[model samples]
Target: MPEFDLIVIGGGVSGITAAAYARRAGRNVVLLEAGDRLGGCCHTWHPVADFWLELGAHTAYNSYGALLALNPDTAFGNLIPRAKVGYHFLKAGKPQSPFGRVGFLEAALTLPFGLGKDKAGLDVETWFTRLLGRGNWQRLLAPAFAAVLSQAAGPYPAEWLFKRKQRIKAAPRKFTHAGGLQGWLTELATGLDVRLGQPVQTLSMADEGVRIVLAEGELSAREVVIAAPLDVAAGLLEHIVPELACRLRATVMAEIETHAVVVPAGKVKLPPVAGLIGGDDAYFSAVSRDYLAHPDWRGFAFHFKPGLLDGDARRRKMAAVLGCEPADFAYETAKTNRLPALTPASVALARELRSALADTPVRLVGNYLNGLSLGDAAVYAAQGG
Candidate 1:
């Protein structure tokens, strides 16, 4: 017999859940992670605040059935009441309604038509413009979506946005843990055979099964599941599975930087709203945190435009958004390449790749395989799709 029934690479949310499912199915599984911590992008920390600050994946909606199913006893932290919701559009350094008067009129006129019947060959920009009118699309929808996805909104397909709308409607209330998402992740990691900092250098097909080569040694497994990012997956499968690697290589990815800044209470009196969305050229589209949960806390979390702002520039953007000098607020930053540019071509290629890998023991599981939410990743990983 091989050393193990399955060897799962990557230790993010998807990988952890994948291993858990495999173990529950009576397979001896081992999970290997390149980083010291298990939750790749689902990180939480407390740098200078009394409450936990999320450096990575923060919230999960009720629609995350797969994640909830995996940890039935886990207690989620708090929920931001729907009535306390706030959204703003930042223009000329001032907050305005997301939809201006003209945009609102346009939305009223066109929203009746809905997102349209055809989603086959339409890009997000065109579909949104048609559904909400040009003014509304430009003023409200585009910037809000750009900030939410951490990438420009034009290239992606309309079907992705349609699915997102369905998810949002399905799960309206978003909840986070008291210790941030890390608390949930830590709970999930328990009772699992997870090895931290054990990065696999290469993978190949062996006569017995799949061979995983690590820096320290090599192991064989009857089955292998790759839950790593597409780029990393492509690199590992280059020689062993060129076709899969080529498909993965064709996937276009976007980089996003998340900043958590804590301002002193009463130092900067922001609008009573929970968050603000910026215009297309604005650095950040949204800024919010669990202000309602911790009434006295002045923490604000921000997501920036992909690949646009770096270290100093990001600091400056944060300062501007918070109406204070960068030195005034205690802040932390985490960069990730988790967002996939799900264009029409990219979506088609992903579907083709899934079909190609359907018969093999080797499987791919992550945000790209299903959708781009933590819930989607968990569902895809747990289902082994």
Candidate 2:
């Protein structure tokens, strides 16, 4: 007999949600995480006992129905609401509102003809350029979208960009947990079996179920859910499903070199705002902790395109943007965040994979399937994909 009813090969939001769903259905399930902690891209760095900085994903929305449905409160009762702030762009080392860059006349002229265009099989650059004039796309939308995605954003699928979903009115529209996003996700995995520092090696279909291989030993489950990164998922599926594996392996991954710093509140000369969008600059975006004020400190995470700067240069650039020197930083941290480098073709690929795996015991879920938002992973996972 299988040792478990279900085995989730990953412990991020995707994996945890899968495990949670299995457990709720009264199945025996286990979650394996290679890292010491959960929350793959939702990393929160704490320099001191009370303060924390988001090194990865920074915000959550009420539209994340799958997550909220499984939430402890089931309503956003306990969630910490984010304070109001505006996202701005910087020019000549000064801050400017995002609207300042919009080409209103161009937008008015092109929007009418662009409204009825289908998003399917179209990239963000192509879709948006048609929807808004080239001037508006170049002047405002391009960089702003890049900042939100932490990558070029041009090749990303237009359909996967902003997935429409209903909201929970009682909950705050935008919020985070007291401990951080990581901690919030941890709470979501509260009753599930999550094993940290456990990396899966390979997956094979057993006579009765799926057999999972690890460096330490092996485990068996009637069903298997792969919620790992795009490349890692491809590797796991290599033996059991070669064709699907090949398709997934062909996908490229994008990297964001993120550097975050926390300084005394008084040290940062720039007034508190949500974050800054990098236009043609070295970085893509810089997120601030201004939405949730810290009495003694403030934090910022700058996501840069890889290969542009080394360690020292990155720190100097961050300091310059923060209106302070490196010496003013009380705490600092860095990490590389990777997401599927998707194209318009990916949307079709995701649908094809979903249809192919529908009748099988194997399952896959992650940001790559839908959108890159925290809600996206939860929704896809909740749907058993």
Most accurate candidate by lDDT: 2
**How many residue pairs collide in each prediction?**
0, 0
| Candidate 2 lDDT over residue span 240-333, tens digit each | 6789889989998999999999999999988888999988888999999998998999999999889999989999989999899999998888
Local distance difference test values of all predictions, in order: 0.72, 0.90
User: Model 1, which residues run further than 4 Å from truth?
Assistant: 74-83, 99-102, 108-116, 162-172, 291-296, 306-310, 334-338
Candidate 2: which stretches are off by over 4 Å?
none
Per-residue lDDT tens digits for candidate 1, residues 21-90, read: 8988999999999988877878776766466666666567777777766764544333332335567876
Alpha carbon RMSD to native, model 1: 3.1
